[model samples]
Target: MQDTLSNKALLKATVIAVFIAGLALVSFILPAEYNIDPTGIGAKLGLTALANPKAAVVSGAETKATIDVPKSVQAADIIEVIIPAGRGLEFKFAMEKFKKMEYQWQTDGAAIFFDLHGEPEGDTTGYYESYAIATLADMQGSFTTPFAGVHGWYWKNKSAQAVVITLTVSGEYSVIGLKK
Candidate 1:
């Protein structure tokens, strides 16, 4: 009799399994991966921070420019930063529509996941334009601002050790620096 379950018992077990899976998805998977915490249980458990920092940035408060650049084109300036292990941050610039800039950046032989994007000024909808997204050790190019706003790279270091990044740029832009 113990070798096989009755049809009713089998059906009940299946239903219970499905219910537990759904609960886990809502309480753990959704919040940890997508930053979706409709039930708030995940936040209570400190799972929301497991989500990619990009999600936080998207939902974060608007940031203002830090340093205003002069009107004339200046020599390329170098900026070096250290990304803490398993952490992420952003370095942005403010520019007017049609302004152009040349940039090059490389890490210390470690590949990093990055998103180069722009957010228009006065936007409250958490909308931004993504110019590039990739995992690479270096990037170099020029870009013309599509709108008067902030542009920057969101660099995520998935490595266990801190990674150093060196960036050089010459453009008509104001340095927004590290974003909070």
Candidate 2:
């Protein structure tokens, strides 16, 4: 009879331990490491940002600007910009409907968080669409505008040191300008 009671107690303890471990995995480990927050606790605790590769750590005001290009002009522009540590900058070009552009950008051996996005022309609601969010040292791609709008990249230098970015563009964009 004593043996039966001891066995029951052992089984109960084992089940409880397993349940607790599962709970920990679901609530903390998965969310903190992989951004899988089924319970939403990770976002409340700000752990999801850590898991996001494109989340920028900005420490100051960001600047933005637009450059106008003649519609009939054809050229290639290479722009270089420097971002201080913990600061961010935005560079964009005005594009017309169905316009296409090829672009390549690289950082000075430092990984930076970036958002590739577009805003429709005369959008007063401050609405924008995000095409990609990435943490990378370099990127190369071609974009075809779905509508008349401004398409560009927002890059943030999250490291402890300043970083220089070089952007090369070819194709149908009218104007290319930087914001701060």
Q: Candidate 2: which pairs clash? A: 63-179, 64-179
Superposition TM-score, candidate 1 onto the true structure: 0.61
lDDT of 2 by residue, 1-180 (tens): 353558889999999999999998888888878999999988777666456423122223334322344433344556666778988888778888888888888988999999999999999998999988999999999888888988898898989998888777777775546644
Which portions of model 2 show Cα errors greater than 4 Å? 1-73
lDDT of 1 by residue, 9-44 (tens): 999999999999999999999999988999999877
Candidate 1 wrong stretches, greater than 4 Å: 1-72
Backbone clash pairs for candidate 1 read none
Candidate that scores best on lDDT: 1
TM-score for every candidate vs. truth?
Answer: 0.61, 0.60
